[model samples]
Target: MTKKIVVLGVSGSGKSLIGKNIADKLDYPFFDGDDFHCQANVDKMRQGTPLTDEDRKDWLATLNTILTDNPTAVIACSGLKPEYRAMLRKGLDDITMIYLKGTIDTIWQRHQKRDGHYFNGREMLESQFATLVEPEKDEALVIDISQDASAVLNEALSLLSKK
Candidate 1:
């Protein structure tokens, strides 16, 4: 069956980069979770304010719509909370989540070099990691991003192949 994979992690965990390669390898459409954000949300993050659950409510709804519309796509999202992931899972049963795991130091290094996005420096990273509720069930793949990107992607691909 075709799958809608949610590549999830805190910022700077390589969710976007890994998601892109996975989508390319699986021949699925790719979506950046950042693109689903509203300008207000973007502005808030740019100002270094962490998003409240209320702030993320509509954004999660929008993502649900996108995944509902394109069932064969792979999306890279922060999806820090289980509630947020559950929101994305609504109306979509054929979904899989890949949690790209990493340590604070690993993420901080990558975050320092990020460009052209609302999140700058280490503020959001701290908030995201703090908010993160790692997947604990069988429906999720907890792959550490501490390794090379190719290694992470390859492991994800192998898991997808099984599904």
Candidate 2:
């Protein structure tokens, strides 16, 4: 069955690249959770502030609603904490989470190379890691981001096919 797929990770982990590719491959809509963020949230990130759970409540709920409304879709989001993931999954099922895993050093380097993104800074990334609760074996297909983007996408496609 086709399912709602979430490409999840910290900022600069290539979630957008993989998520969009998978969405195209599956002929599903692509939703960047970043795009769903309110201007206030965007401004906070732009200012190098890490958002608290309360800050994410509406954003997470809105993403969940989008998933519910479009059951077959792929979304890129930083599902950082267990509660956040739970929020995304609320009122939905058959959601496949693909976590792009990497160390802060790797992600920090990538973040530096990115242009015009609001989510910024090593400090912010550190806060994200601090809040993160890695998905268990059953909850996600974890793809290490050390490999080339093509390799990561191929692996994700292969894993999704099996699912």
Candidate 3:
């Protein structure tokens, strides 16, 4: 089975970490939406400026294309809003949506540990949370990311088998 998976959450929710694990487990390719951001958007984030919807428009479209273009892969993206998720699913019905859920305090702690990443705007995490619209139960497999990465990966893989 060719699987197209997207692990979504706000910054520092461990989407990328777990996305990579999921891809490895399934022997599928892994992509980080962050890697596809335009230089301008990267600059904005690097300057502690939150990217507006305008800044994200092209990047989101690119990610959408990547998912649609790939045969089988797992992607990690900060799919904060419903519109963003919709764009990602615009014409694809088989995409597996996984939402990494955690609290502000939990994710904040993890976010602070990150090193040499462009998304260094610690204050932006709050903005990401404010913009986030969590997927409903019917739309995605929601995984709690307050635990260790291995535990979270096991939980997601376990739920995925039943999905």
Candidate 4:
């Protein structure tokens, strides 16, 4: 059966690229969670400001609604915090979080090379790391970001197909 999949990670972990590819392969709607951010949040990130949990609450709520409503779509989201992941899980079952795990250095390197992205590499790196609570009790498919995107997607798709 089709299932809701949240591709979770810090910035520059290639969640969007991989998630979109997986969604296309699976014939599911792909939603970039970044698109759900409000203008204020976008402005803050563009200005190198880190978002407080308060700043993200409403956005997360909206994501929850979208995911719940869609039932089985793919979402690329930085579900960095445990509580945030829990919030996403609320009122939803058959949801799987695929964590694209990587070191801060790797993430920063990727972010720095990103020419037109909103997030400031130096500033948000720390915040993203700080907010991160690694997937609980292996409740996710933790793929290394250093791997090839095709390989990573293959692994994820293999696992998801099993479920």
Candidate 5:
């Protein structure tokens, strides 16, 4: 069976970085969900405005289509809410959801260091956390982002191997 992986987390939680690493390791195509966003959504986020659920409908549908098209792909997405995650999982089965778990301070520091990203400021992070419904232990392999990238990637690889 083809493996479908979604590296999900709040903004600046290293979803893109970690997802890319996993995709390279697994030899699967990698996609950043941010890239699927419409120009209007990108503009709003670039202006430091948080997107509402309505603004994300088309973007989520696009990501879902990507998953449907490439069954063996790795995607980085801010699947913060349970509804959002559910939307992504609409048609797929056997998906591995990897949650990059981190504290607000840790992610905030990463956000501060990020350059040229549409997610402009730390102000939106709060809203992200507020909307987040953390994946249950049974539903995801939760990796602590406090660890170095290599260690986290190693752990993910090891855990995924067992599945």
Candidate 6:
């Protein structure tokens, strides 16, 4: 069976960084969910607007198709709501979710330093947290983001190895 991991979190919690590291370590293809968003969605978010569920359906479907196409891959996505995560889980097997859990303050600090991304500011981060339905204990391997990237990546790899 294919092995897939979804690295999920609010923006600036390091989903893309850690997901890329995990993918590189595992020799799996990496997909950034942001890259799948339509121009309209990008425009909205670039203007500091939060996306509605309706705006995300097609994007989620595209991620699902990417998952199906790349049997072994790591996906970086803001799988914020339970419904969004559930949408990604459809028609898949051997999939594991890793939530890069962090406090708003921690994420906000990182957010401030990030460059060249569409997600504009703390308002969007706040919106993401508001919308987030944290992955249940049984649904994901939750990793704290307080540690450095290497430590975080090592911890994730260690946990995933057992599965």
Q: TM-score per candidate, in order?
A: 0.95, 0.97, 0.96, 0.95, 0.96, 0.97
lDDT of 1 at 77: 89
Return the clash pairs for model 5, or none. Answer: none
RMSD to the true structure for each prediction, in A, is: 1.1, 0.9, 1.1, 1.2, 1.1, 1.1
For model 4, how does the per-residue alpha-carbon lDDT over 3-120 read when each residue is reduced to its tens digit?
8999999988999999999999999999999999999999999988999999989999988998999957999999898889989889987888899999988888788778888887
The runs of at least 3 residues in candidate 1 whose Cα sits more than 4 Å from the true structure, single-residue gaps closed, are none
Off by over 4 Å in 5: none
Provide the overall lDDT of each model, using Cα atoms, as 2-decimal numbers: 0.88, 0.92, 0.89, 0.88, 0.89, 0.92
Please report the candidate that would top lDDT against the real structure.
6
The number of residue pairs in model 4 that clash at the backbone is: 0
For model 3, the run of ten residues with the poorest summed lDDT: 117-126
**Residue 41 miss distance in model 6 (angstroms):** 0.6
Q: Candidate 5, overall lDDT?
A: 0.89
Residue-level lDDT tens digits of model 5 in 62-146? 9888999985999999988888888898899878889999999999988888888888777788888888899998878899999
Give the per-residue lDDT digits (tens) of candidate 3, residues 24-45. Answer: 9999899999999999999988
Cα RMSD of predicted structure 5: 1.1
For model 6, residues 1-163, the per-residue Cα lDDT tens digits are: 2399999999999999999999998899999999999999999999999999999999999998988888698999999988999899999978999999999999999988988999988899899999999999799899999999999999999999988
Give every collision pair in model 4. Answer: none
Model 3 local distance difference test score: 0.89
CA error at residue 33 for candidate 1, angstroms? 0.8
Model 6 sits at a Cα RMSD from the real structure of 1.1
Give the poorly placed runs of model 4, Cα more than 4 Å off: none
